[model samples]
Target: MFEQALGIFLMLAILSVLIVVHECGHFLVARLFGFQTPVFGVGLPFGPYISLGRKWNTEFRIYAFLLGGFVAIPELGDETNASNSSEAFGVELNPFKKFPIWQRALVAVAGVTFNAIFAYFLMVVMFFSVGRQVEQTYVSALDPSNPIAKQAGVLAGDDIVALDKHPVTSTHEVIAYLGNRKSTPVTLSLIRDGKPLDLVMTTSPKGKVGMVLGQKPAQYIKIDAGPVETLGLAGSELVDRTRLMVVGLAEMVQALTPDFGPAQPGAPPKPGFKNLHGVLAVVKIGAGMVQIDWRSMFMFTIMISMDLAIINLLPWPALDGGHLAFMLVEAIRGKPIEERAHGEMVKWGFLSLIALMVLVMVNDVSALMNGELDIKPEMKEKLKGR
Candidate 1:
């Protein structure tokens, strides 16, 4: 019970920090533009609020609900009905519509920008402190009975220099190359006893290349990166991770669609919530990670930060991307959208977000009740084997 409580506390603390960083992006950018930001809050506004001091004339607040946060900029079409009395203290209170389109767009994008930046910062620290895990591409073992290895005449201790003429530096690259060329011929360049050789091998029916690529024993070697190199590494990692996340999200969306074909005679029935993960699933994952170690917890938090960055930038209503889209349209049209139309759009957008949240929560509950939420680690190991 104590462990469970500790997990919950850690999850909340990490989430709260991420939320504050995201909202601060908006708040700080808006303040820089001379906009009126009355409330900078952590967590959704509910119950009584406690004042956490003021910055730049903004009242920092801690609310009851801890799921997410907001930066209440009264001038930025805020629905909070906050008094404009503070407007008298500065330049005439200009509505968000009166601001330059670029400035408004910047405010809309600032939150996502900060999330990405935070993720990159976490990655840099991780690299400097714990280092990254990497694998070597040398062949350590070969199964003679495996068709691909036998046909290619590959021997143990050979380093995979290339696949299809592309340099292979890691076992991951070899697996990726073979996985994509299942049952197809692939060219493998090998270095054996310091002599280079080339061979063609066809993958087996199950996409196995029948080679066990070797890895140096795992060790944490901190990267000694200069300022410029650190920046370059951080930015590159952020971009690569974001791209991978997009592909993964697309796959998850595809998994949501039901496969209508009849099941094979002896095959097990398809699971209803195969790739869906919701709030409870995330919390459960957080709990497990915290129990393992701080490095694992930090790693998960960094990934979540990046995920939030990408998710908020998705071009859907009530999202940062959606707001930026409206700003872009205004820029192109030489005018802001009609207030009523904008309100209607926001209403629909909010409802859609709520609906999505509901669907995800329902899926999470279903997975929990049906014993599907606990298989993630096993599934991850299986994927790694592939």
Candidate 2:
């Protein structure tokens, strides 16, 4: 229990710190470009900041909300005048009253780049400092009670070395391989008590393996590499993870439409704000990481970080992506749009965000009540079979 609590604390601390850094990237870039920044905060205007600072003598000041931070740049509500500049009323940076379109776009993109760097560094530390867990290729428990195990001649303690000619490294891979019930007669390669063996297993109707396996202690393996190789690996992983998240979100959105299959068959028909997950999910995942081993925990953290970075890149109001979209249009048209038009767009975006939040909260509550969202008792039992 103490271990779990400590793990939760660490996870939360890491998440909070990373988010603050991400926001800081934007704040710093905006400040460098001479934008007027005011208040910067995190955690929905309610949470307290861990650190706060400001430029005392200068025209602009900085504050760290600890929970999160943002630069109150000069571009709010059509006002683009630099804070220190004494320009005409309602006018921005000299000609257009705001920084160049490219400058604004760079400010928006900076946060995302920072997040990717943060994730990469975190992964490097997780891999080298903590070490990676070795692949577990054994079936720790066959549970004689499980019919599928019996049918496949796989007894408890049997070491499953491979699946359909593919090497098995972890219990996760074991389930993923055997869980293919949709494919008839799954193949398996086993090594029982030093004797090599081959076998085939069948899946249940729901594409389940119908059996559970356990894991042994994690083995610490060393990675030998120069700084260049280490940096390359980290960068590659971050890029891949980011790409996966962006593609996954696009697929999810596509799935929500009527042209696709039924809309999750459980919630509302359209994709709205309610689908948005907030701090609750963050807290839960952080808590779960401590309970599990470090490798799983850190891997999950990487996934979540990738998700956060990608989600913020979406083109919607009040988001970096939205700001980016406007900048792009300005770049193409050779001028910024009217202030009134931009304000209306922001207003609609705010309303949409609020509506979506309500839906997500409802969905979270519903999932809690239905016992579908949280890990089920049976699933836990299945995981612990080893």
Candidate 3:
């Protein structure tokens, strides 16, 4: 129970910090360009809020909905909407002087830019402390149903280097290979205590021999990266994680089709909308990770930061990327968009974003009830090695 509380706290705190940093990027860049940002608030704009008074042409306040942050950069677009008022904030939107396209673009991109920078910074700290995690095929435990491998003297911590004389890299490879050859005799080349041995065993009919696998530094060793190497690795990690998210998002969209079916058998489900979730699942999974090792939060935080950056970059209204897209259209047209049309699109986008959030929340609840979000005990034991 205490673990659950800590997990929630950590998740919210981390997210709040990321939000602040993102908003600060826009605020600072706007100030740099000498634009008056009438309001900068932590959390969403609507709902009951308390004003922290004005500072440097910005009215700082904390809002009740603490999931997102915003700054009123008047030059960017229609900063004063129905929920927000320039008159209430005691600042006037400049009527005559608006920043050029380049400046507006910079302000729009700054939030994402800051998120990227902060993610890399976190990566540096993690590399220096816990090093980079390179997941591999290591047996962390033996299942009670241990049929062949356990009886053949396989033990925990044994690295399965090759199976059937072919090198196997990830746990997925090992599981897939064994699952396909159920009840068939196969040779496993394992490294135990730094020594290698070949053991011939037959898998159960289900293709599993009670060997449990672990990923993300649980069953693998860490590589302490140097300064230069860390930079290269950090860059690669950002790109890799971003690519994975893109693929996951695309799969989710594909899953929206009527004909899509479930992926994977005798293993974890493949990425799709069926498994796509929102903040609830994040807190649940994050709490599980925290209970195992606080260091795990670094990876979670980095992923969330990158996810925010990517999600905001989507060319939708009510998002940073949407604002940038508007700027692009404005650039080509040689004038700003009609005020009412732009505002209407933003209103619709805001509603769409909320509706999507509600749907994902429902998904999160359903997943929790079905026990799909629970962390496997075998994986937990592997992380415990730290």
Runs of candidate 2 with Cα error greater than 4 angstroms are: 1-11, 46-53, 56-68, 76-97, 133-220, 260-277, 369-386
**Candidate 1 lDDT, 1-386, residue by residue in tens:** 79867986888788878878888899889989988776777776657777887767677778787787987765555333224424522223334435677777888889888987888888877777776533337788887667578566888888787888976555665776687778988889988888999989788766787887775433344567786887687677667656657766765665566878875686655444535566677877677556644455655787788888888887776788878877778778988678677767877887888787888888888877887665366333322311
Count steric clashes of candidate 3. Answer: 0
Q: List the candidate 3 regions with Cα displacement exceeding 4 Å.
A: 78-84, 87-91, 94-96, 137-225, 257-274
lDDT of 2 by residue, 1-386 (tens): 78757766776777777677777788788778776555455644433334344452123223343344455455533223244323422213433244577777878888887887777778788667755435455666655545776777877777777778876666656665555545467777887888988888777664555456765545546557776787676666566556555655765787565565444555556655445565555555456544554456666677667666787788887777888888878778988767678877867886887687677667767655664445445434333321
User: Per-residue alpha-carbon lDDT of model 3 for 3-101, expressed as tens digits?
Assistant: 789888888888899999899999999899987788899988887788998888688989998877889876678545433455655566655356788
User: TM-scores for all candidates?
Assistant: 0.73, 0.65, 0.75
Write the candidate numbers in order of decreasing lDDT.
3, 1, 2
CA lDDT scores, all candidates in order: 0.71, 0.63, 0.80
- The global Cα lDDT (0 to 1) of model 1 is 0.71
Could you report the Cα RMSD, in angstroms, for every candidate shown? Answer: 6.0, 6.9, 6.6
